[model samples]
Target: MNLHADAVTVLSAWAPSLGSQESLRQAFLGFLATRDDTVQRSCEAGHLTASAVVLDSTGTQVLLTLHPRVGRWLQLGGHCEPSDASVADAALREATEESGMTGLEIGAAPVHLDVHPITCSLGVPTRHFDVRYAVRAPAGALPVRSDESDDLRWFPVDALPAGSEDLAELVNAAVSSH
Candidate 1:
């Protein structure tokens, strides 16, 4: 089967397991089956990627981003690219690039998997399959803003900004697992 067909097959098999949040599930399945060359190229080029949930010294605080485009606070992450040798590497790279924190230690297991819709300049939606990993931020690390984010800050797991429930859950899971 072709890539699109294979993607569809994979999506169909997994869609039933996605529970509610039908829109998110459908978009995720659609993303898996996308035949658009641009989208395919983006994924293939590693521009469609994964990310990390960096926990600070106390493990009570998690670093997050105030996204400029989506205008929402979220975990630091981005697309996986050709230079990334592995999924963990992609997550680490995105964390470093987006948060400017060095000496990050990525966890061995994925805490959660989420798919979100991102609309670019032309108002077309792209899907991001975020594979979230738990990570430890370097001691005394300070988060700095990058091109992808407007601001970076650390927030307590239970006291995250409004609308950050999903991120908070993921971060909490990661922390608990550790």
Candidate 2:
């Protein structure tokens, strides 16, 4: 199937799993229904993005990047590329690239969905319809900083650095479910 069809199928399956959050789930499904080009960067107003909360092997600490553009310590993720086959694949790919680690385990279902405004790499103002998944880093894994981030580090899930309350919520939601 083509990329757009694939995204539609993926989002359709995921939407219902978002129990009790009818509005968020419907919003995603509605986007898929109305926006045939939702997966593409050219969507302009907004586009689908994927992200992950990377947890250490023991699941006590989480890896985060200090995003240069956003200037916040957040989970590892970014815009979906053409090579990404599905939203989950995009999340996994972004986690691997940003964390500099191999063999990280990721699930197919998303842990959270967010719509946030940001400046794209091309300097365009747009919102990201972000689908976040839970990923577990290999034991003793060390993450090297990527060009997208100012720094990368693992912090205690509960004691995350200041200004990371949003990330803390995602991490908690992901961890509590597992």
Candidate 3:
């Protein structure tokens, strides 16, 4: 199937009752219909990005990266690479790379979907349709900061560092699901 069709299939199969998730599902459907570069980084309008909410073995803590560009404590995720076979695979790969955890387990369905604006490395303003999945790290897993982040740390699920309210919501959804 084509990328847009594949995205429709993925989102249609995901049963999310939350208002945000529902809105995102609808918006993604529209985006797919109107935009051809759903998986390309150079899409000035916007493109799909995958992210992972990495939780500890007990699910009480979550790993967050201090994104240098955004300067926020956010989930471990990034642009969708050409090698990614699915959105979930992109999220899993990003989580493993950022968290330095070898045995990370990621859920098949996305736990959250968000569309937000940002500036890409190419210095172009763009939007990202983020598909976020829940990922569980092995016990006592420690994250290592990559070039994409300024710092990497684990925070209690209830006591996330000061950041976006959306981050907290993502953690809640991930925690309950995984």
Candidate 4:
């Protein structure tokens, strides 16, 4: 199935970790039911984005990218692309592209769901309904920073950036799910 259909299937079957997430999941499914283009960036109303919290082989370190545009550390992910076959593929693709790491394995189900507003590449205010997964980097895999990142580094699960609550929560969800 296509990414749009796969998103519906995946989220429909997913179990939310928090009470708040269930409403967001319902919203996502509702959006998908109305628009075929919800998976693409062109849908200005808001779109689905896939991201992953990159956990090290040992699950002690989390890889984060200091997004040049947002000027903060975030999970490895981005807008879903036409080439993406599924949400999981998009998450893994973004993780590999931004982290420059290979042999990454993504969990079969999402670890969390989040929606936030931003002026992304579209250059207009938009909302990103993010589907987040937990990904495992290969043992001894070293990361190289991409042009998309101001910095790409791993932080101990307990030592995430001082003010990043979202990152901390994503890490917590990913670690707990693992």
Candidate 5:
């Protein structure tokens, strides 16, 4: 199936843990129903993005990136590309590239959904409908910082950096279900 079909299938099957998330899912589905180009970054209204809350093999650590543009430590993710087969593929690809880890495993369904406004490379303000997944890295995984991020590091699940409350919520939801 195509990326749009894959996104619909995945989002349709996923059961959000919170009522708020379910509402977002319904909103996303609604957006997709009218905007077939929702997966593209050029979509002026807003676009869907994929992200991953990466956990260590023991599930005690979470890897995060200091987003260059956002200037805050956040989970690994980005806009969908033509090369990405599906939204899940985009999430895994972003996670692996940003973390530089080889044996990462992603969950079958997304763990969280968020909608935030930003002025990205498109140079215009738009909302990012972020679909986040829980990904697990190898026990001995070592990360190499990619140019895409200012920094990439793993922090204890309980003690993320200051002002990372948003990521904390995503991590908590992912850890509980991971």
Candidate 6:
């Protein structure tokens, strides 16, 4: 299937809140409009990326990246490329790449979605419309930090690290979504 068709299929399957193709198309277009320059370029160039939050079987634990630049623990995700046929694929790909965990299994549906402004090392503004998904890793699978993260650790859902209220809310929502 083609990119647009694949996107339609995935969205139709997952986002039942969207009632029709026209609504889904509008939603997608609305998502596109919210992107910053970097993300806009990526989408225009057809290189949109995604990410996911991986949890253990009990759902009490979550894997987080200590972002090098942001200096905070966050879910694994990144830019979408041409190879990623669907948003879910992009999210799962980023999670695996960043966490270095094998046998990653992403849920068929998104747990939540959020858009936030990000400025890269060069101070270029970008908007990330993160399609956060619930994912599971094999038991005993250890996470190795990639260059994107200074450290990788599992945090208990009840005891999130110190951060902005917004982040706390996002984390809570993700946890509850599972």
Model 4: per-residue lDDT, tens digit, 19-108? 888898999999899989999999999999999999999999999889888889899999999999999999999999999999999999
- Candidate 3: C-alpha RMSD to true structure equals 1.5
lDDT of 5 at 41: 94
**Model 6 RMSD vs true structure:** 4.7
Select the stronger candidate by lDDT from 5 and 6.
5
lDDT of 3 at 14: 89
What's model 2's TM-score?
Answer: 0.91
**Sliding window of 10 residues with minimal summed lDDT for model 5:** 165-174
| Candidate 1's TM-score | 0.73
lDDT of 5 at 109: 88
**Which 10-residue span in candidate 6 carries the lowest summed lDDT?**
38-47
How well does each candidate superpose onto the true structure, as a TM-score? 0.73, 0.91, 0.94, 0.97, 0.97, 0.76
* Candidate 4 pairs with clashing backbones: none
* 1-178: candidate 3 lDDT, tens digit per residue: 6555667788889888698689888898888779677877878789998999999999998898988888888999998887777788889999988877789999978899999888886588889999899999988777778887899998999998865566788899999896
Model 2 CA deviation exceeding 4 Å by range: 15-21
Better of 1 and 2 by TM-score: 2
- Alpha carbon deviation, residue 132, candidate 2 (Å): 0.3
Q: Which of the numbered candidates is closest to the native, going by highest lDDT?
A: 4
Each prediction's whole-model lDDT (CA)? 0.67, 0.83, 0.86, 0.93, 0.91, 0.67
Q: Could you give candidate 6's per-residue lDDT for residues 33-104 as a string of tens digits?
A: 454332323443222346687887677778888888888878888776667767788788898999898898
lDDT of 2: 0.83
Q: Is candidate 2 or candidate 3 better by TM-score?
A: 3
Off-target runs (Cα >4 Å) in candidate 1 are 1-48, 121-123
